[model samples]
Target: MAEQCKISAAIVAEEKSCVLKLDGYSRAKGLLKNGEFIISALFNVGGHDWAVKYYPNGIKDHADSISLFLLLESAHAKDVKAKFKFNVLNKNGEPVSSYERSDWGSREFVKKADLEESAHLRDDCLTIRCDVTVIHGKEETRVPPSDLHRQLGDLLENKDAADLTFQVGGQSFSAHRCVLAARSSVFKAELLGAMKESSAGSIEICDMEADVFKSLLHFIYTDSVPLLEIASNKGETDVVMAGHLLVAADRYNIGRLKQICEEKLCTHIDSNMVATNLSLAEQHGFSRLKEACLQFLVSPSNLEAMMASDGYEHLKSSCPSVLKELIARILPAEYKAAKDIILAI
Candidate 1:
C-alpha cells in the first residue's frame, strides 16, 4: 500500500487593513445632546469610505442610553462588506472589553448602560477602536510573466524551427532568423537588408567566443541569462563573461542587453577589472559605465592601488588624454594647500 501525504496551502494577504479610532468622547458628549448623532471623520477601509456614528443620548427605544454605529459613508453598486472587531479601551490604554464579528455591518454596537457597567468610560470620556479586514471578493486567474519567456527558451534549447546557423570561434550555433531580427536591430539589418550574409544560410562571427555568443542568444530568446551567482569568488568568471557580453550587446545594438551587462559589470568592479572595464566603456561609448569606472578609480582611497594594476598601463597608453584629469584628482588636498611653499622651494 502507498503511504499517504498531506498537502497544505494558504492565501497570503496582499494588502493591509485600516484602523479607525475616535478620541475626545467626553467633550463631544455635550454637543451631541438631544439625541443628536455625531459622525467621526471619514476613514478608508479596503478602497471604500466608512465612518463611526455616536449618539450621545440613545435613539428610539434606547433613549436612556448612548448608541454607537459603524456606517458605510459612500455609495456602492454592491454592499462593501468587511470583518471587524470593536474595542472599548480603558484609561490605561488597554482593551477593557471587545466584540468581534466575522462580517460586521451598519448597526448599533454599544448601549450607554452597557458602556457604564463595563467601566469602559473614564472622566466621561470613552475610546472606540475598529479593526477592519475588507473582503477582496474574488480571486482572478492570470498567467505569470515567466511562462512566455520559458516557452521561447524551450524552443531555443531544442533548436526547433532553426533557420540560420552562426559559426563563432569554430562553434556552430543554430537559431531562428525571425527571432533574431525581432530582438536586435543589427541582426535585423544583417539578416534582412541587402548584406552579403543575408543571402547565405550560415553566417560567420569573428572575434566573439562561442560561450559569449551562446549567452547572447539565450538572452534574446529567454529575456534572461543562465544564473551567474555573484556571491562566490568563482563568480569572477561570470563577471568576465558579462564584460564580453557587454561588447556583443553594443555591437548588436541591443540596448536592454547592454544595460544589463553594464549593471552586472558595475557590481563586480575591482582593482584588476576597473582598467579593462573603463577601456571597454570608452570604446563602446557607454557613458554610465565610463562614469562609474572613473568615479571608482578617481577616489583618493582607490587611486594609487588601481594605478598598480597591469591593465592600468594599457588604459594609460590607449587613452592618455584622460590622465591629466586623473592626475588633478589624485593630488592630495594637503599637497594643493602647501603648493605655494613648494613653489618657493
Candidate 2:
C-alpha cells in the first residue's frame, strides 16, 4: 500500500454552508397536500452530503406549524459526527429564530407556527440558513476517465475493420457489432442474442430512412445528436428528420436519443409544424411533446392562425384525442361537446 500523509488541522478541515431560499412557495401549494416537500438536491457540507427538507404546512400531526429538518444523505460507517446550526430568516435578511447543536446527528431543526404568519413567510417565500461542520469523515477517491469509449467512437467513425454492416433504406452503414450491442438493447438482441440476425453478417432495416438511421448510428457512437448532419435549404426538413429520428430511437430502445429528439422537436415547433409534431408525439406516446403542442394551440395568440394552417386538418385526422385536451383547456366545463368548444374558440 502507498504511504499516506496527513495535513495540519487548519488545512485539513473543510466546512461549507448555504443559504437556501424557497421562493414561489405558494405556487407549489398543491405538492404540500401529500407531505413534506424536500429540497430537490443534496448539498455538500464538510465533504459530506446533506439535505434540507421542508413541510410547508408542517407534518400530519403538526399541521399548525411549518417543519424543517436536516438530513444526512449518505450511509454512515459509524454514527456521523457533526455540528449543525439552523436559522430562519425574515424578509429583511435577519434571523427571526436560530438553533444550534454540537456533535449532533440528523434531526428536526424547527417546527413553528410563526412560519405561517406574514413575518416569517413574506411574499409567499421562505429563507433558511444551514451550517454544518463534520468532525470525522473519509475522503473519496476520484474516478479516472476510460479511453475505451473514445476508441470505440473513433473506430465507428472511421469504419475501422467493421465487423457488421447495416443496410438501412438501401444504404449500407458499417459499425462494430460489440459497440452497437453495448449501447442499445435492441441491437444487442439482434446481433448478440438468440435472434436469427445474430448469425448474419449483414442486417437490413427498411422502416427507418437513411438519414435517420445515420443519426441513430451517430448517437450510438457519440451519445449525442448532431442537428446539422442533415441540413437542407428548406429549414423545415431538420424538424421532420428529428421527428423520424425519435421514432427510430423508440424502436431501438434508445431512451436518451428519443428525449434528445423530443426536446429538439419542441424547440422547433411552430404554427406550420405544430400539428404534425403533435401527431408524432401522440403516436409515440410522448407526454412532454404532446403537452407542448397542446399549450401552443391553446394560447389565444397562436390558436386562430394555427386553426387555419394547412397542417391543422392532418393533426385533427391523426390525433383527435389532443383536440379534446385542447377543448377542455379553453372552454368551461358546461360546454361538453367538441363542436361547441370548437365554435367557442
lDDT of 1 by residue, 1-345 (tens): 001111111112332233333345545554555456766666666777766666666677656655666667777527655666555555555543333222343233454554554445656556655666677766465563446675687688679989899999999999999999999999999999989878789998889999899889988987775433221235467678888989998999988888888998888888878888888888778888877888888776677777888888988888765555456455677777454444444
Models 1 onward score TM values of: 0.55, 0.52
Counted clashes in each candidate structure? 0, 0
Candidate 2 Cα lDDT to native: 0.68
- Candidate 1 has an lDDT of 0.67
| Candidate 1: 10-residue stretch with minimal lDDT | 1-10
Residue lDDT tens for model 2, 207-254: 788878887887888775644322322478778888898898899899
Model 1: residues with Cα > 4 Å off, grouped in runs: 1-140, 143-146, 230-235, 331-345
* Deviation (Å) of 224 in candidate 2: 1.9
Return the lDDT, model 1, position 102: 26
Model 2 spans > 4 angstroms off: 1-149, 228-234, 333-345
